[model samples]
Target: MQGDTKLKVGILTFHRTTNYGAVLQTYALQKTILDLGYDVKVIDYNNEEIYSYCDYRVLYGKLPLKTRVGKIIRYSHNKKIAKTFNKFRNKWIDLSVECNTNAQLQSVEDGYDAIICGSDQVWNPLAIHFDFDAFLLSGVKGKRISYAASAGNITLWEKYLKKYWICLHRFDSISVRESEMIQPVENLSEKKVRLVLDPTLLLNKKEWEKLEEPLGNEIEKDNYILVYYLGKNRALTDTVKKLQKQTGLPVVLLGRQIEGIKSISVPAGPSQFLSLFHHAKFVITSSFHGTVFSILYHKPFLVFGNGNYNSRMNTLLSALKLQSRMIDNESANLERINKVVDWGQVDSLHKALKEKSINFLIEALR
Candidate 1:
C-alpha cells in the first residue's frame, strides 16, 4: 500500500469479451496487482461497437426469414457459452461500476492512483475499431501506464499512423507483449517501449492450478490429446487425427465441434479451461493462450500457426529456445510430435523473463 491508504489501480482492457484468452489475461493481471497489495479494479466499460457485431438484437432488423432463423439458433447456443463466461467474471474479477459510455468512464477517472491498459490486443485498431479514447486512458487524471499491451499482428494504415502516435504518447510508460511490437511502437511514440511477458505468464503453473475446476468423471478417466483451435482450418483436424494415431490417445476438442472428427466437445469456462490443459496427455493447438498453458504445464505439445498471429507464438517459443515445437501443415510429422522438449532450460528462461516483467510492473507502479 502507498502511505496509509492503499493505492487504487484501475485496469482497462477487453475484460467483457467471451474469448478465453481475453478474460483469463484480465484475471491474471488483476490478481498480480492485487497480490502486490494495491487495490485493483477492472474498469467494466462496455464497447458497444465491439458488441454490435455479436448482438442478437441485430437479427431483429429486416432480413430473409430463413437467415434470421439460422442466426437466432446460433444466438441461443452462444447465450449459454456467454453465461459461463459471465459467471467467471462475476466470481473472480473485481470490476468498477458498469460504464457504457465515455462520460461514465470519465466520472471514475479521479478515483485511481494509476490506470493501466494491457496484456491483450487492446492496441489493435481493427479489434477496437481505432477507438483511442478509452484504452489509451484519455480523460483519466491518474498516472497512465501500459503493461504487456499487444497491437496484435496488424500493420498500421497510413491514415491511422498519426492517431496511433498521438494516443500512445499519452502513456507515462509503455510495455508490450511481443518483442516485434517494441520497435514499431517506440518509433511511433518516440518513447522507449519495454518488452514484457504477458500477464498470464507472470503467474506460474502452481498458481494457475489453484483456479482449475474438475473435469467430468468420464473425461478424467481418459488419456487424451487436447485440441484447442480458434480458426477454422481443415488441416488442424487432420493434424489432430495424426497425433491421436501416433500417441494412441483419443481426441478432446475444445470449442466448436468439427463435423468429421470423432472428438468430445467440452463446454468450458476459464476455470475448466485450465483443468483441461493441466490434464492433457499431448496438446495440439492453434491459439496463443493454448500454447502458453501447454508450456506452463510442461506438456508435450505441438502448435499450429494462425496466419499473422503466428508472430506472438513464435516470439514466445523462440525466447524459451523451444522453436522446434511449432509445426506447419507440411512439417506436421510424427518425429516433430515425438521430439522431446528441454523443460529444465525452458523453465529457467521463463523464470528470468517473468522476473523482468514483474520488475517492470513494480517500477511502473512506483
Candidate 2:
C-alpha cells in the first residue's frame, strides 16, 4: 500500500509534554506514518491535569510556602524550555484541532481511518494523570491500534486488568514497547501482543541526524561527556566525576541543574538533545530514551538502572546483546567504558527488529 491522501490517521500520545523523549517519540511516529503516504496528524488531546504538571502556575495555590518559592525560581527556566518544546511541536508535528475533554476527543474520532495510540507510556495512568478514557480510545468507532505503547512497569497493569481487558478488546491490533509487557497485556486482552522497538528506535541514525541541530558556540568545539539523568542518583554523579577526572574532558549536563556537579547547563530541546548525544565523547544517563539515542548514534555510554523502572532499559540492552552497558549497582566498573561495542553485529540485529516493527505498522494500516 502506497501513500493515500484519503486514509487519515491520528496519533494519540504524550506529545505536549516538556520531556525530550515524549515529544521526539511523537515526532518519530507521526513522521514515519506520514512517510508511508497516509494523511496523519497527532490527536492534540490536551488534558488539563497533565497540562498543570507542565505549567508551574497551576500548582501555585496548592503547594506549601517554601515549595512554592522554589517553583517561582524555576518558573522562568522551565518557561524557556517549554517555549523551545512548543516551537518544535509547531514546526514539526502536524496536530489536529485541540481537544481538552474526553467528549472533545471522542468527537474527532470519526475523522480518522485508524487511531494509533502508542510509542510512549500512554497506558500508564500516573504518566497521564489517570486519563484512561482518552488513551484507551473508549468510544472510538473506527479501527484502533497501538504501536510500542508502554505502561512503564507491567505490575501497574495487574491492578487494572479488567479495564485493560475491556479497552484492549477495542483495539484492532496491539503492540508494546517493553518485552515484559507482552505476557501481561496478552493475558489481559487475550490478544497476541507483539513486542516492538520504541518509536525513537524506529528511525535509524541518519534519519535522526537530519533533525539534529548544532550545539552553537556552547562547547561545540570541545570533546565533552554528555550526562543526561532523569533521577538524582549519587552513584551516577560520582561516576561522572570519576570519568571526567580519568578522561580529562569537560562535562555537559542536559536537563535541570544538579548540585555538586560542575557541568555546563545547556537549555536543550529535542533537536539539541540529538546533537548532544551525537557529538559526545561518551554518554551517561538513566533515561530509556537517553540510552536509545546513545545506541542510535553508536556512542560509548552507560545507563544506570532507574529502580523499578529499569525493565524498559533492561529489555532494550538485553535484546541488542549490550547488557554490559547497563550499570545496576552504585559501584560501576569503568573498565566497561573502554570496552568497544560491536556495531556491525548490533546493527544487524537492530535492522531485523526495525523491519519487523515497520511491517506491523504496514499490515495494521492495511
Candidate 3:
C-alpha cells in the first residue's frame, strides 16, 4: 500500500435510509477502500447537503416522487412484501433537502480525491428516475471513476449517448458489475469497461458482521430455508405454504411486509438481513442480493424472477452459471419441491468468477 498518497474516496449510494442492501453495499465499498489503505467515508446519501462533508460524491440517486401522495401512489402499485415506496420516497425527499433544500447543489460540489458512481442499479432508468448520465453532461470537478456501475441490463439509452460517449473520456478508469454490461457501456461510452463484482460481493462473510444485528435473539443456528420472494403471485405463496406443510421446516421469507404468506417476514434491516444470509439451509430468491449472499455462503439456491421483472438479477445469475436455479415467473411451476443435487458446475463457475472479480477490484484500487 502507498503510504504517501493518502487517497480519499467518496461512495454515492442512493440510500433509502431504511435499506439493507444499500447499507451493506456501502459497508463493503468502505471496507474495500479502507483495505486499499485510503481514507474512506460513506456520504450520507439520502440527503444532498451531506455531500458537502465529503470531497467526492459517489451517488446512488433514487426515483423521484415529488410529493407524499405521488410516493404513496408510486409504491402502492408495486407488490413488495416488506419495503414501501413511501419509505423510499421519504429518503429521496431528504436527499432533495440535502441537495436543493439549500437551493445551491453546485455550491457543495468541491470536496476531494475521487468520486465513485456505482456498484449498483444506478444505470436503471426506471428505478432511479433521473438522468444517470447527468454527472457526465453537467461534469464534475474532481477525477472521476465509475467503479462496477450498472443500471441492471445490458441495454443502452439513446438519449444520453453523446454524453455517455464523452464521459468515458473523462473518467480516470471505469468498471461495470456484470460481464454483459461491458459491451453496452463500451459501445455507448466508447471506453473499455472492466467487469467487477457487485460491491456487496467485494467482501466475504467475516465482514458482514458489522452490519448484523445484536445476537440476542438470533434464532438458534438451525437448518431453515431462506426464501427470498418479491413476487406476490398466489402460485408462489401456495408453494411456500405447501413447502412448510411438507418440510415442516420454517421458511423465512425476506422482504418488507406484503400479504398472503404465513412464512416469517424479515424486515429490511441489518441484523436479520445478515442472519438470513448466514444461516439459511438453502436460499430461494428473486432478489440479486439474495443470490449474492447465497453464493458467498456456498449454499445452493433457486433464483426466481419477479412477475415481469427486469434484468438486474438475471444478469448476475447468468454470469455466475446459476441459470438453472432461476425460474421465470411465467414458466415457474410452484408444485414441484425439487432439490438440485449436482451443483458442482455452479460451484466451479462461482469459484472462477470469484477469483477474477477479486483480482479485478484489488488491481483497480491501486
Q: Could you say which candidate leads in TM-score?
A: 2
On lDDT, who's better, 1 or 3? 1
Error of 1 at 115 (Å): 0.5
Instruction: Give the per-residue lDDT of model 3 (tens digit) for 49-79.
Output: 3222221211223544355445454344322
lDDT of 1 at 16: 86
lDDT tens digits, residue span 1-366, model 2: 446545889999999988999999999998888888888999999887886645545465787788777777677677888888998999989999999889989988778889999878989978878788888989788889999999886677666778878999879999999888898888778888998889888888999888888896868543999999987787788889889889889889887667776789888888888889989999999999999999998889999889888888998998899999988767577888779899999999999998899888998888
Candidate 2: residue 178 Cα off by (Å): 0.6
**Candidates' lDDT values, in order?**
0.84, 0.87, 0.58
TM-score, one value per model: 0.93, 0.95, 0.74
Per-candidate clash tally? 0, 1, 18
By descending lDDT, how would the candidates be arranged?
A: 2, 1, 3
Q: Give candidate 3 regions above 4 Å deviation.
A: 1-4, 47-109, 131-138, 153-156, 214-220, 256-260, 307-310, 330-355, 358-366
Task: List clashing residue pairs in candidate 1.
Answer: none
* Model 1 residue 149 distance off true place after TM-score fit, in angstroms: 1.0
Clashes of 1: 0
Locate the minimum summed-lDDT window of 10 residues in model 3: 50-59
lDDT, candidate 3, at 295? 73
